[model samples]
Target chain A: MSSVYVHFFSVSLDGFGTGEGLSREEPFGHAGERLHEWIFVTRGWKEGGSGGVDDAFVQRHDMGIGAEIMGAGKFGYPGWENDPDWKGWWGPNPPFHTPTFVLTHHTRPSIEMEGGTTFHFRDTSPAEALEEARAAAGGQHIRIGGGAKTIRSFLAERLIDHMHVAVVPILLGRGERLWDGQEGLERDYAIESVSSPSGVTHLTFTRR
Target chain B: MSSVYVHFFSVSLDGFGTGEGLSREEPFGHAGERLHEWIFVTRGWKEGGSGGVDDAFVQRHDMGIGAEIMGAGKFGYPGWENDPDWKGWWGPNPPFHTPTFVLTHHTRPSIEMEGGTTFHFRDTSPAEALEEARAAAGGQHIRIGGGAKTIRSFLAERLIDHMHVAVVPILLGRGERLWDGQEGLERDYAIESVSSPSGVTHLTFTRR
Candidate 1:
C-alpha cells in the first residue's frame, strides 16, 4: 500500500510552520528562512554541505515520492489566482518531478512544466484529493507538500501515514501554527525524536 | 549573582504547558499527567526508577533553588480563594522546601508549612514578584515554578536566565500556551536540545 507522507516540514519552537505577513516578496513572511536555514546548509540541499544528521533527514524529501498535494497558499501568493501568469514559486523546471495537485477553490487548467511535474488545480476535500493523488502515484508513496494549513487539514482528517517535522529553535510569535486543532494527535501515531548537532530536533510520526 | 531558572517545565508538542479545564481534582487539567508521565518513571520522582537522561533532567528541579515564584493557577484550583481551609494540592509538607511566592490577584497572609516551605501570596507584576522572591532566596538561585502563563510573562520581560523545557509527544489542543507573546525569543538565549531514550526531548535555553 502506498503511504501518504509529509517530509521536511519545518516548524518553530512555538509550533508555527510559517510566520505571519506572508507576501510575494517574503514567502515565509517575517520568519524569513530561519525555519529552513538548517536544511540549506545540509548536503541534501548543497553539494558540499554538512553530511551529518541534518542532511540525513533532509535527504529523505525525495525518497520514493510519486506525487504531491499542496495547498493554494504554497502554490502561490495570497492573490495568486488574480494573476494568471503565476506559474508557482518554483521556476520553469520545478523540484517536484511528479503530478503535483494544488488544492484551490479557484481551479484552473492543468499546466505541464518543463520537468515531469504537472500542476493540477483541484477544488476538493483532503480525502478526495488524496484519492486522486494516490491514483496518479502509481504504487509509489504520495507526498503532502504543505504551507502549514494544508498539512494540518490532512493531519486533522488522519490522512497522513508518516510525517517528519523539524522543530526549529526560533519562536515566530505570530504565524500560522502547525499544531492548531490537533489535540491528542499522538494517539494515532508512534512518534520518535532525534536532536541534531545543528540545534534542530527532527520528529517522526508513523501511523500505528 | 543569583540567576532565575525554570527547571523541568513540560510542554506538549504543540507548545502548551498546561491543559485546559483546570479544576480541584485535576491539577494538570485535561492533560492529566500525560505531560509528566516521563518524570514519574525517572529516578528523580520515584525510588528505583530509571536513572537515565530523563532522570538527570528531572533531578535538576531541586538543585540550588532557594525560592520559587509560581502562578496562582498552580498554587490551587480556581475559586480556591473562597476556601480559607484549602491549604494546597500538596499535603501538609509541600515538595518545595523553600519560600514559594504565588502570583495571584487576591493576595492573602503568608502560610508556613512543613519541610521549610512557605506560601506567600503576592499580587504584583513579574518583576516586582521576582524582587521579593530574590530577597527571600538569600543569594541562592530562584526557580520559576509555572502553570504556563507565569513562565511566559517572565520570558517576555527577559528576566529568566536559564530554562529547561521537556517537549512531550502529546498534543494539548486547548490549554495555556507557554510560547505566546514570546516572539523572537531565541535571539536572547543560546539554545541546545538533546533527545532522551525515554522518548522526550529536553531543551535548554541559557541566556547569552
Candidate 2:
C-alpha cells in the first residue's frame, strides 16, 4: 500500500509552516519570504530542478515518497483568474513532477508538466486526495505537499507516514499558526533521521 | 541599551533539541524541560500582556512575552534517538514563556495567536534582537526564559533584562547542549518572575 508522507515542510523557528495573509497580491504575507530562504539555497533544490530550490536538503531519499497532495494556496487562487504567467511558486519545473493532487474549493482541469508531474485540481475531501495518491504511489509513499491546513488534516487523522522538516532560522513575529486548534494527533511519533549542512537542518519522524 | 529576547524555544518537533545521544534516561537532553515546552501555558505568557491582565481573559496569556529569536534546530529534529520518553511534540507550556524570537542562519517565523500575539523567528541576527524589538513595541516585552543557546548567550551578552518559563514538559530528549558550546553570562541577573500554575506552565517570565 502507498503510505502518506509530509516531506520538505519548512517552518519559521517559532512553529509556523507558512506566513499569513495568503492572497494573490501577497501569498505568504509579511516576512513570508524569509521563511524559505534557507531551503532555497539547498543543493537538492539546485540539482532537483526545483526553481524555488535552496540548500536545505537533509537527504536525497531518506524521506522515501510516492505521491503528492497540495493545497490551492500553494498553487495560488484556483479561479480561472490565476494568471497562466503565474506559474506555481515552484517555478517552471516544480519540485514534484509526479501525480500532484491539489486541494481546492473550486475546480480546474488537470494540468500536465514536462516531468512525470501532473497537477489534478480536486474538490473533494482529504480522504479523496489520499485515495488518488495511493494509486499514484505505485507502491511507494504518498506525499502530502502542503499549505499548513492540508498537512494538518492528514496529521490529525494520523494519515502521515512520516514528516520531513527543513527548519530555517527566522521569525516574522506574526502570521498563521501551524498546529493551532489542531485536534491533537494521538499516538506519538518518533524521529528516525537528521542531517544539516548550510542554511537549514533537516529531520524525519515516523509514527511511534 | 538593546535587550535580546529569546522566543518560543523548543526541541526540533522530532523530540531532540539538545543534540545527539539523548536517551530515554535523560530526555530533553541537558536543555530538557527547562530548555523548552513549558512556557506556552505558563502564567505570565500572554499573546498581549501589554493589554494588561484580567480574570476575564480567555487566551493563555501567561506564556506571552514580547520579542523572540531562535536557531534553526529549535523546531524539529528528524533524527533517531534512544529516548522514547522524549515527547518533544508540543502540547502545552511549551518552552516559550513569551511571544519570542528565533534566530536562523536563515528563514523567518510567522504565527499570531489569540491575545494580540505574533511569533517571528528567522534570519534575525542577535545584534538585531534588542533594537528591532524595542522599536516594534508599545511597552517592555518579556524575553523568552530559557533554551540553552538562547538563554546562555544572553547572559554573556548581558542583553536580557528579564527571564521566566515553566518546567513541566518532563525530561527525555537529552544528552548535553546546555552549558556546553556556549559562553558564560558575564553579568549577574535575578529571576524577576515566577509562578507555578497547577504546576503545568510554570510562571517565570513575570516577576522580573
Sorted into a CAPRI-style docking class, model 1 comes out as high
The segments of candidate 2 whose C-alpha lies over 4 angstroms from its true place after superposition are A23-26, A47-65, A77-87, A90-93, A182-186, A192-201, B1-208
Cα displacement (angstroms), candidate 2, residue A116, comes to: 2.4
Task: Provide a comma-separated list of chain B TM-scores, one per candidate.
Answer: 0.97, 0.46
Tens-digit lDDT string for candidate 2 (B1-208): 3334443334333222364444444434444444433443333554533222211121343333454454434443434223323223343445443454555454443545444435555565555765666665546554534446656555455565544222222223333333332211211433221112222222122113
Interface-residue RMSD per candidate? 0.7, 14.2
Per-candidate DockQ vs. reference: 0.90, 0.04
How many residue pairs collide in each prediction? 0, 83
DockQ score for candidate 2 = 0.04
Q: Alpha carbon lDDT of residue B132, candidate 2?
A: 64
Residues B109-184 of candidate 1 have per-residue lDDT tens digits of 9999999999999999999999999999999999998978999999989999999999999999988999899887
Can you list the residue pairs that collide in candidate 1?
Answer: none
Q: How much is the TM-score of the A chain of model 1?
A: 0.98
Which stretches in model 1 have alpha-carbon errors above 4 Å? none
